[model samples]
Target: MPQTIQGFSRLNKEEKIDWLTSNFLSDSQNATSILKQYWNSDAKLQQLHDEFIENTVTNYYLPLGIAPNFVINNKTFAIPMTIEESSVVAAASKAAKFWMSRGGFKAEILGTQKIGQVHFTYTGDAQKLSSFFELTKSILLNDLKTLTASMEKRGGGITSIELINKNDQLANYFQLHVTFETLDAMGANFINSCLEQLAESWQREYNNYPVFSENNAEMVVIMSILSNYVPQCVVRAEVCCAVSELTEADGIDPEVFATKFVQAVRIAEVEPYRAVTHNKGIMNGIDAVVLATGNDFRAVEAGAHAYAARNGSYSSLTHATIENGIFRFWIEIPLALGTVGGLTKLHPLVKLNLEILGNPSAPQLMEIIAVAGLAQNFGALKSLTTTGIQKGHMKMHLMNMLNQLDATDTEKSKAIHFFKSNKVTHSAVDSFIKNLRQN
Candidate 1:
């Protein structure tokens, strides 16, 4: 039975682990050993990792892979991907190689505006609030001088602020909508800090203005935060080639492949169930690169999914078409990523990953991430149209299954040889191992 304890956080790392294992785990010694096993060898580095979050226990790890021969904008790159899934890097690499011979990928940034808001409530005159906001907009900006000065010096700062009235949607609710140009940084902290300052100034300014005293109501500040759904921070990436070029050794006709591919994409666009899985494959590539580069994958994911449903229906983020003998595939996603801030500055692998990509700016990073998604989507759709998803995915998953079964070196070698000509599945591998051991 678990019991409450005071100041569990104040305990040392060892004490914390001891308490956790003693209270919760049946095998406390092994649990503690496992936790310590993942700790960094370098004490300083381990301390750095520990400081990343509160109640520090240990590190969690994922494999970092290199998907080579990605040619975007006529520039070749080997993107770094950090993920645990089987076949993601392989699929991405295959698609990248296929597109490399064609025109490669062309990408462009559509926009770079990020949004934050201050939610407040007031039963006062709506007209009076609007007029006051118009007059006090400069005051709000003036109050953020200290906050925006550094960002402005780098050619990015607050762009606009507007008063949004939402009384009909929710009683006495209003918003101070603000947009920003964050340049290279993801700017979550910067945006949030500026919003807090703006909120404080707004309350102070509203209280000082005696014109609001007639209403006998207070302007209540609800919350100030940056939004993860950044529709404006979007990028587009595409690949195009002659329909004949799509033909391969698999004997699938280029015209048939193109038709099937476009149909697959169309199904995803209309069917929410298919669209969800289709987009998951796209994010397999995007999230790998995003995580390897130390950006917020969760934020990018939320924004992308929200953008897919922006038209009142959840649809595919990727589009496809075959026009006049030209087959084209593309993806457009809202990815509010950063190359400079957050974990980029601290994690060693993130630094190297950024350098490997030639140190892209935030917009440039957005472009590369978008291209990864497109490449991954192409790989998945091509497999779905031609051989089938399982043929390659299960083959790639064979090693992981073998590892899980703890097959010996000789058993693993035999299993590899056998599965080369046979289909792979959990029961098949288990039976193969059992026969090998018995014989």
Candidate 2:
């Protein structure tokens, strides 16, 4: 029998951590040990540690919110997200619930392969160098093969190779695109290592001296580098949901609502002004999960935005439509993420999170991420479609106001009620609190 997942809203912070440990971490003692490595007993130290964890170490506790009622590929999954924005979780949960009312989200993943690039540059004859590399392609490939023999044994190896001319104001440079089939791993480290070895061999073969710079390197006034951009793999997901679930207590057709929602996203995708806010919504969920799992959120953000504009047209990362009285959603992005090595091994909480995800392989992880991106996009669209996005958000913002006011439970309740009933104001909250006290 499978274990039950506890609802996040019901548990406090500490309880949530404990539950995560119980469900994900195989050994409580190990989890505690890992926690102790970073956490201190002193209050001030603990606070500093928390900041460090958020800023430097694994920032898993950003904002562990919930997206409930997700039925993907006919299986129910309650997504626990760590995002700072207010509307994303609520909107995703609402979308999931709406979909469940219909038949739930249906999704499928294409494959689990990422592209890595090997760029070559020199002042020498470009045509000659290309001819040299081509003549020695078999030998160079054999070298790469030897370097990645272990990976090849694991059913992964360099699948394709290409060369491109990147022209610029300074000079034209040659770029070598090395495509690899990385199975169950991010393959960054592996790809870089193999490329560096190949570069050394290329340097020996050609007198131009092939230099492998992770970043742009200064080579006697000319610079050449290898990067992580080769469009080798693609991941796709689709969701179809019903409209009635989107209806409030009052009767409203969610399919019509979804049309309006798509219009809002279209505005965001086209207009530069709305595009900023639109991308912000997508990042709200992406950064949170990236932070939670000890991954580099900044890189992911950069890559996502760059990909959004990859087609030379500013566009939304998602597409939504209404078909057969149901709302359909789709998303495609070049998400080059890793599951093994790097911080995934360094951070204990990330390990715990991955374990809770049931040790998903790289393909499975990519599939989950693709789904998350779609779910997040759906959520933003839903919010922009109805309720104006601020009403629900401001209600949650009341928590901060309550904290600032230092109001008790009853006082907070009264203040919120009074604020909502009337025009919200500081004076109004104070007046309501005073009235409550008098009563």
Candidate 3:
């Protein structure tokens, strides 16, 4: 039974933890200790973390790792990834090295447009509204000149605005569909601000417009917000190599692997079940880098998934081709990242990660993220088509299993050496540890 408390946010950090643990946790003291244990030792740093969100109890930490040897567009980079999952960093590094010898990855931004909308209800004639919109569109744009001055100076601002009629879908529904270009920033704040201002200006005009007044109808402004599903903010990254170069020492044929990999991608393209996991693998890489760089992974994820389902059915974000002794694998995804906003300036680690990548611009970051996704997908598909996913994944997971079982360093060393030639499983490792301890 949970008790609701008023002004929970007003409580201090320790007080908040006390209430949460007392109500929810069985071992309140232990949980409180664990939460406090992760807090930063430095007072300033701890305060920074606390102010990031409401109801702050303590910090939650994830491993910040580096996957080196990535060469995108002929430039080498060691990308930082913050994730709790095992084997993702390993797979990305392996795939990057594989492509490095094959001319590296080629990537480019396809588009950089973001959108926001103002929804409202009008019970008047659609034709009259259209005429009114046409007449006042310039006035509405002019009203925002002051608001958009700084953005326009920075080479980004409102690009277009359209009056959309949705009365057929819902009675008296309409929208102001606005597009923008906000270079070097995610622009959520900027987009929403412009939408709100536009809504304010548009409503004032609506009140004065005689057409709706003559019909004794009123236009009610609803809400204004920036959309995360930016289908227009897309980047493409790919790797290509001579078929002969894709050789494995285990005697798997390159052509056979390529064919199987392509088929696997094809299965994901048509099957929703497979597409979800297939895309998840890609996102494992994309989201890691996005988070490491201090951008919004949730927004990137939403946009990417919506873009994949743009054809009315969910499909793969990656594609493959084999022709003329050449094999090419690629991914195209919507990644609206920012290098100049949000946590980019606040988080210390984010600053270091950006420096590690040579301080790439927003579009450049998009290219890198897309390449990461493609590399991850390639690594996964290759493993799935050849040696099986568990062989490598479980091997990487052995350390975690050892930690869970509380094995000593000697036992862990023995287990690592033993599992090199043997398949890794929970029971086998448990038994190995038990037997080694007995002997």
On TM-score, the leading prediction is: 1
lDDT of candidate 3 over 1-439, digit per residue (tens): 9899999999999999999999999999999999999999999999998988888889889999999999999999999999999999999999988888889999999999999999999988889999999999999999999879999999999999999999989999999999999999999998998999999999999899887888988799999999998888889999998888898623789888888888999999999999999999999999999999999999999999999999999999999989998988888898888999799999999999999999999999999999999999988998999888999999999999999999999999999999999999999999999999999
Clashes of each: 0, 0, 0
**Poorest stretch of ten by lDDT in candidate 2:** 215-224
- lDDT rank, highest first? 1, 3, 2
lDDT of 1: 0.94
Model 1 deviation from native, Cα RMSD in Å: 1.0
Q: Which parts of model 1 have CA positions greater than 4 angstroms off?
A: none
State the displacement of the C-alpha of residue 205, model 3, in Å, after optimal TM-score superposition.
Answer: 0.5
Question: Cα deviation of 161 in candidate 2 (Å)?
Answer: 2.2
Model 1, residue 430: C-alpha shift (Å)? 0.8
> Candidates' lDDT values, in order?
0.94, 0.64, 0.93
Error of 2 at 39 (Å): 3.6
TM-scores for all predictions: 0.98, 0.76, 0.98
Clashing pairs in 1: none
